[model samples]
Each structure stands twice: as structure tokens, then as C-alpha cells.
Target chain A: MASTDINSTVETVFRIEQARLIAGLTRMLRDVGLAEELAQDALVTALSEWPASGVPDNPGAWLLAVAKRRAIDRLRRAKMQERKHAEIGRDLDEDRGDDVERRDAALDDDIGDDLLNLIFIACHPVLSPEARAALTLRLIAGLTISEIARAFLSTEPTIAQRITRAKKVLQESGVAYEAPRGEARVLRLASVLEVIYLIFNEGYAATAGDDLVRADLCGEARRLGRILIGVAPDEPEAFGLLALMEIQASRLKARVGADGEAIPLPEQNRAQWDRLLIRRGLEALARAEALGGADGAYALQAAIAACHAHTGRAEDTDWAHIARLYDRLGQIVPSPVIELNRAVAHSMAFGPEAGLALLAPLETEATLRGYLPLYAAKGDFLFRAGRYAEARAAFDKAAGLSRNTAERNFLLKRAAACGPARPVMR
Target chain B: MRVMVMVKATKDSEQGVMPSTELLEAMGKYNEELVKAGIMLSGDGLKPSSQGKRIAFDGPKRSVIDGPFAETRELVAGYWIWEVRDMAEAVEWAKRCPNPMPGPSELEIRPFYEMADFGEAATPEIAERFDRLREDAKKR
Candidate 1:
């Protein structure tokens, strides 16, 4: 291989190894920020040495060994500084030596646990959601500051500062560097799942961006979800979350029109849906169900998506089954969003009157007052019921509330289609 | 984006020879790593070309061709569709793959063309036309 190929190869290997290196180091040093720095130090060492020496047989192990040595050197220097300042006893040195040896012995073991602990720490509820996302991408995904910034559409320095502050908060709060147990484990796992889902949604549906979907964030979140499943294989909810993401990601292509407009599920070209992802998702959903997660929020949602996946033509969708699933889901999660979806499903399965009846209570809901989808759903039901004027008004309301250019255009078009031969009032 | 990584067929693969147990084990482990990393969407190995058939298309005519095909190097023994951040990431993962054959082999990585790649040409009308064509083809 040429010198440049070797250089690129070294960097690629480092990218693959960095997460494991940092996870193991954090377990040893008990400091995520310091572990990251030492990992970088090891990368630097490899860049200088590996090009000429050629890559090692086990590059990850090589990098870990180098980082461990640097960590020990740093610890020894810090202890020496403390000794010089306070004239500490020799027994302190002996205790430190034993501690180092013990940590070293435990380093190679429980690496999977170490990785899971690192993920839990990164997604700890104490940190702000943005900070948690930035930190997770940085520490767990081995993404650079610029990559994180590009992914989130933020500036490099802002992301760097966010990561820095998150690390400081983690250190000051003194979160344990180990996975929780029993009930605490369940709670912590929820937070981790929430962060991953949030990342996925941020990519799946950009809340505030010119781009409709940022596939990179979705890919990162899916990768993290898979890692979580690997480490916590017994957690049914983890499998559920992975299933949900995979099923949703499968439709990413069909979800948008060629003109960059959002296409409702019924209108999307089903041929574009990725069959492989759908199969993977269904398999994951089965796993979740086998693990007694059938009622889990993500599992239920994945099941609903599967209903659509099973049908080729839109008219062939099992709307009645979907409505039943949504009804069950609403009982478990109890969100207005679920209620709105249930209403739509009911309308499709039964009639527009049924949907309108279900949505009547939501009209008075303060949370749904400004929600664009509620009005859009109302407009569709009203249109189907032949109440053209009311449908037009509802679509107009939805169009007024929408911030996305494509969505607003779609709503405006719907509104125009509602009335007979009248000029649109913009 | 997504890329299809194809393991090119070697003479050994084209001869319908099965992989050794050790090679299969290594490939299985590598696949597990890919899944754990979450890049793999789907993957599978194909039977030898001898068991496959090909269709040839002309301007207005079609002909059927049976394999084993010539040019072993151009044949694909197996393939994986991986969603990656970029081509660089895809290359990194492909480099880590266990060699598919007992002898010299190659892995080719080609990215799928997304709708976005079409720029302004990907209007809804064109897309609908293509969809209609596909539906008609499926019916046939």
C-alpha cells in the first residue's frame, strides 16, 4: 500500500477503535473527558508510529495499551505533585500503586458493561437534552466536534462548548460510571431510549431546518440503538425502540415527494420502501413481543408500522387493526398525539363522522389548539364528509400554523381543493 | 446514504465450492460486528452462477441466457446493503470484512442513487410516471 493509503487506514482503524478505547479508559480513570483526551493521545501515537511500522494485527488492543500507559503516567505525575505539596506519606503511594494494578486487572473484563455504563452516563437525565445528544455523539459515536456540528446544523465552537459544559456537569454531579440496577435501571434505560428517539426524530423530521430530513442523525441514532440492544439484550424496550426506528427509516425515501414536499403515508410510493429494513424491523418487533414488550410504547408503534408494511396498496391497509392498536397505545401512553392518530385511523376504518366525533374533544385541548396536524386531520375528515367550507377553513388553519414551506404549500393546496371554484384568500 | 458492497466472484466461488468452516465462522463474526455497528441493512450470499439465469435486452427484443457466466471476476458471490454516513465510512467497514474466498478476492462498494441526486430533474410528475411504469411492470 502507498503511504497515503496507510495513513487513511490508520485513521479508519482509529475511528472504529476510539469508542471502545474511551469506554475502557473511562472505566479505569472514572472521568469521561480525560478518557477522551487519552484516546486522542493514543491516536496521535498511532499516527506517528503505525505508518512506518505498518498496522498491527490487533489495532484496537494496541491503541488501548498505549492509552493505558499514558493514563498511568499522568496519574503518577499527579500523585508526585500532591506529595511535593503536602509531604504525603509513602503509604499513599503504595495505596495508589495497588489501585492502579487493580484497575488494570479489571480493564479487559466487562468491556460491554463499560460501554453500556458510558452510554448511560452520556444520556443521564441530569444533562440538558442538547448536551446529552452532543456528548453522546462525541463520546459514544466517536464523532468529531465538526461532525456533530454539521449533523445538528450548529457551529463547531458551539458544539465544542456544549460538550465541554456537559463534561463539567457530569464531573460535578458525580454520576456513577456504572449501569444502574433494578428500578433505577429501568428509569435510566428510559432516559437513554428517549435521547436516542429524540435524535432519531430530529433526523427523521427536522423540527426547524430547511431540510426535511437529516439522515445522518437518524443513522447515528440507529447505530446507538443497535449498540444499546447489544449491551442490554434482555431489555425488550431496547428492541422495541430499534424496531420502531428501523421501520420508520425504511419509509424515509417514500415519505418525501420528488419536489421535497412531505407526502402523506397514503400517497407515498410504496415501491420505494426498503424491504430489507422492513424485514429487520418486523424481526425486531417479534423479539420485543417475545420479551413481553407488546404493550411497550415503541413496540406498539412498530406494530402499527408493520400493519402498513404488510399491505402493498394503500386501500388494502388494515385501518381497523391500526385503529385498535392506536386505541391500545393511547391507553398506555395517554398523549393527545396518540389520540389524534387514533382519530385518523378510526376515520379511515369507519367513516369521517367517527373521526370527527373522536376529534371533537381535542378541539378544546389547549395543547392541540395550535397543533398543525390536528387541524389537518380535521380538514381531511370534513372533506371526506362533504363539508367543503369547513374543510377549507380547517386546512387554512393548518396552513397558517405550519412553518415548513413544503407542508404549508401542501396544506394550501388542500384548502384550495376544498371549495368550488372560488379564489384562494392566500 | 446507502451503498451496496459486493464480493466479487473468484474462480473458486464460481466453481460452486463452499467456504471452509473457519472462513464461514470468521465471516459470521464480521457480520455480527456490522450489525452491532448498525450499518448492515441486509446481506446474503448467492448460489453459484450455474444455478442462475440472465435476461438480455435489446431495443425491442429480449433473450434468455443461462449461467455459469464467463468473466468470473465480474460476478457477485454475495452482497450487503449498508447505510453509512459517507463513502469513507463504508470503505472503513468494507476493509474490516473477512475475505469472502480462500484466494484473492475483491469487494466493490457502490452507493445507491437517491432521489436527491437527481437535482431539479426529480419532479413529482416524473416520479409518478416512473411509479406507474413500475406498477405496470409488477403486474406483468
Candidate 2:
């Protein structure tokens, strides 16, 4: 590749690798800020050098090796300081090479509490869940503010401000860099898990863009979950959250077609489902269950996923069990979205009337006013019940409200299936 | 008395790889040194860009995207919250540290805004609610 190509490649890869690099650098520099600076220096080196050197086989490791050297240089300079002159002069008298060797040794310590702590720090309670999510996505996930904004059908400036303000608040509040433990950790873990899930959900059901899902987002969330498992192994909710993500992510491959069209859950091919993720999700679920996640929101969501995972086809789904789980989830974390999901399950468990009845109350909810899924789910129930005119109107409204191209297409198709619109009811 | 060190991440540091064992120890020692020196109030590193995401809001609508971002110069990789007497002390400590990056790195030190700085502009309700806001975050 030409130097230009090499530079571009380095930049692209850097986004993917930034978190790992910062994690590594923070250990050597002992300053989160310093570690980030060192990591940037590594990028600058690559930008200047890689054009001619070509990308290294292990580009990340190469950058890390380069960053650690810079840390050593600082140590040497500090050793020569006036305050350290007496001790440093004596130490320098022994061997200057020893200093280099020691610095090298210090740069490579590997038990990784720093990276784990970094997660908690990024997901700190000082910011809103959205703010924390944005910051984590920007700082830890290496996502651009615009890309994050696009994922949620949101605007770039708002996301950018959220991230900037979140950092400012964290700075102002004197939040610690280490992970919280004991009772405090419960709060921290919930935020962390929510951030991860939010990231995954965006990928799994992208709010905007042409595609229905962003596989990269799903993959990244799973990666974070696995890391969280290592960090907070005993936290059942952590495991539950991971399990939920893993199981849900397993369907990504089958959720769309070769043509990039949306494939509803009932229509998805189980054969395309990732068995590995299923296994992992089940394992994580087992851990959550063992740790007593019976009442946890994530665990309940995981249980709901399990219901889907256990069945071979959509027809085989245990809707009654899913309805119960949704009910439980709603009780713990009451939200319009949870209710919407439960209504779907109720429709599946009983019949269209049951689902429509469940959804009837949500019509008055202000928050669900612009929510497309509500109309789509209600439309599905109405369609099944041979209420074509009403279903057609719902689907049309869903098509109008949805931002996802694939989802919009699906809703439009459903509307078309419902036949001609003739003074349809709202 | 408190200052924050903002470290910018370049597109290069985010690789899906672990640092060598030696590097990890070196980092721990460096943190230990900072702690021993009393310059570090607290510090920690972040995960690679691949591990995070961003959420952009355009009014009530939200958008998200995966990371390992493109811009290196403007990106914030991590931060250190330090307790120091003043900017001079913060700079002095920053200068004493090893170079942050493998090639070369820069550290940007910024002071935290004091509550008093807000003066009468910030309502008491806003100030009191700040803590409550944080606690609310914990619940979500």
C-alpha cells in the first residue's frame, strides 16, 4: 500500500484498537491522560513511519512497544531532576542501560486492573445513561460522535456536546479512575451494563442508516461484555447482561438477507444463527442463574432470549413463557418499550385480540407517540385478525415514523399487503 | 487544587491486542510512583476503541455508531484526575513523567471549575440537583 493508503489504514484500525492501546498505555504512564497521549504518539509515529515501513504484522503490538519507549524516556528525564539528583546520580553511576531495562520492564506489567477500572470510570454515575453511553462509545469504543449519532437517528452536535460535557463533569466531580466495589458497584455495574446493551441494541436494531443492524456495533458490545465478565465475574447482572447481548447478537446474521433487506424474527432462518454465541449466551446465562439473576432486568431479558434460543423455529417459540418474562421485566423496570414488547408476547401467546387489548392503553402514552414499533406490532396483530383497514393505516404510520430503511420497507410492504387505504382510522 | 490531564488518542493506539506482560508491570509501577508522589488523585486507562460506541442526539432522536474513530488529534483517549496546589504543580508533575507515547506524547492539563466559580449564576437547585442527577444515573 502507498504511504497515503497506509496512513488511512492506520487511522481506521486505530479506531478499532484505541481502547486496548489506551488501556495498555495507562498502565505504563500511570495517568489516564498520559496513557492516551502516549497512545496518540504511537499513532503519529505510524502515520509518519508506516507509509514507508508498511503496516506491521501485529500493528497494535508495534504501537504499544513504541509508546512504552516514550514512557522510559520520561523516567530517565525525571531521574535527572534536581530533587532526585542525589539518588539518581548514584543510580546513573551504576548503569544508564539499567534505567532503560527497568523502564522496559515497567512498561510490560499485565494483570489489567487499569483497563477494567477504565470501563467503570467511563460508565461512571456522574453522567446520564445516554451521556455515559456516548462517552464510552467515543472514548472507549473509539466511535466517532457522528457515527454514534447516526446509529440513534440523532444529530451529531448534540452527541458531541454530550460527550464534551460528560468529560467536563467527570473532571469537575473528582470521579476516581478505579472501579467501584461493594454496594457502590451495584450502581456502577447497572450503568456499565446499560451502556453496553445500548450500544448493542443500536447495532442490532439500528435507529437509522440504510441497514437494520450494524454488525460491528453488535460485535463490539459482545467484546465489552466478555471483558466485563472478566472484571466483575461475580456480578450476576453483568453476566445476565452479557448473556442477553450474546443471545440477541446471535441472530444478527439471520436478521437480514443477502439483498440487505430486513427479515422479521419469525422469518429469520435459524440455520444462520451463530451456535458459538448461543453456547456462550447459555453459559453466561447459567452463570447468571447460578448467581441469582431471577429478578434482574438483564437476566429477565436473557431469559426472554433463552425462550427464543430454545426454539428451532419462530412457531416453536414459547410465547407464554416470554410473556411472563416480559411481565417480570416490566415490573422491575417499567418502561413503554418493555410494555410494547410484552404486548407482542401476549399477542403471540393468545391471539390478536389479546395483543391489541394490551396495546390499547399505550395509545395514550406520550413517550410512545412517535415510537414506530408500537404501530408495527399493533398492525401485525390487526393484520392477523383480518382487520385490513386498521392494519393498513398502522403500517403506513409506522412506515412514516421509522428511520431505518429496512424497517420502513418492511412496514410499507406490510401496508401494501393490507390492501388499499380508504379513509383509514387513526 | 484539582486538575485534569486530558490525553489525546491518535488513530494508532487502538489495536485488538494485549500489551506484553512487562508493559503491564511497568504501568502498575508508574501508577504506584504517582500515588506515592501524591500527584495522582486517581487515574485509569480506557479500553480500545473497538470496545466502545457513540450516541448522537438530534433532538429526541438518538443515533449510535461503533468506534475506533478516525481523528487522532482531537480525540480524548483517557484522563487523570489529580489533586495539586495549582497549575504550576500540575505542570511540574507532568514534566517529571516519562514520555506518554512510544514515539512522543503531549499532556494537556486543565483545571476543574470550582463551584464558587459559578457564583450566583448557578441556581442552588441546579447545584443540589447535580448530585441527585449523578445518583439517578446510577439507577439507570
Q: Which numbered prediction scores highest in DockQ against the true structure?
A: 1
Q: In model 1, which runs have C-alpha deviations exceeding 4 angstroms?
A: A1-6, A80-112, A207-213, A420-426, B121-125, B128-140
- Measured against the true structure, the TM-scores of the candidates, in listed sequence, are 0.88, 0.58
lDDT of 2 by residue, A117-233 (tens): 677777888788888787777767676777778766678999988877876787678776554665786787788888998888777765223432253577667767766776556
Superposition error at A141 for model 1 (Å):
1.8
**Model 2 chain B poorest 10 in a row by lDDT:** B130-139
- Weakest ten-residue segment in model 2 chain A by summed lDDT: A88-97
The candidate that wins on TM-score is 1
DockQ of every candidate: 0.42, 0.01
lDDT of 2: 0.72
Error of 2 at A248 (Å): 1.9
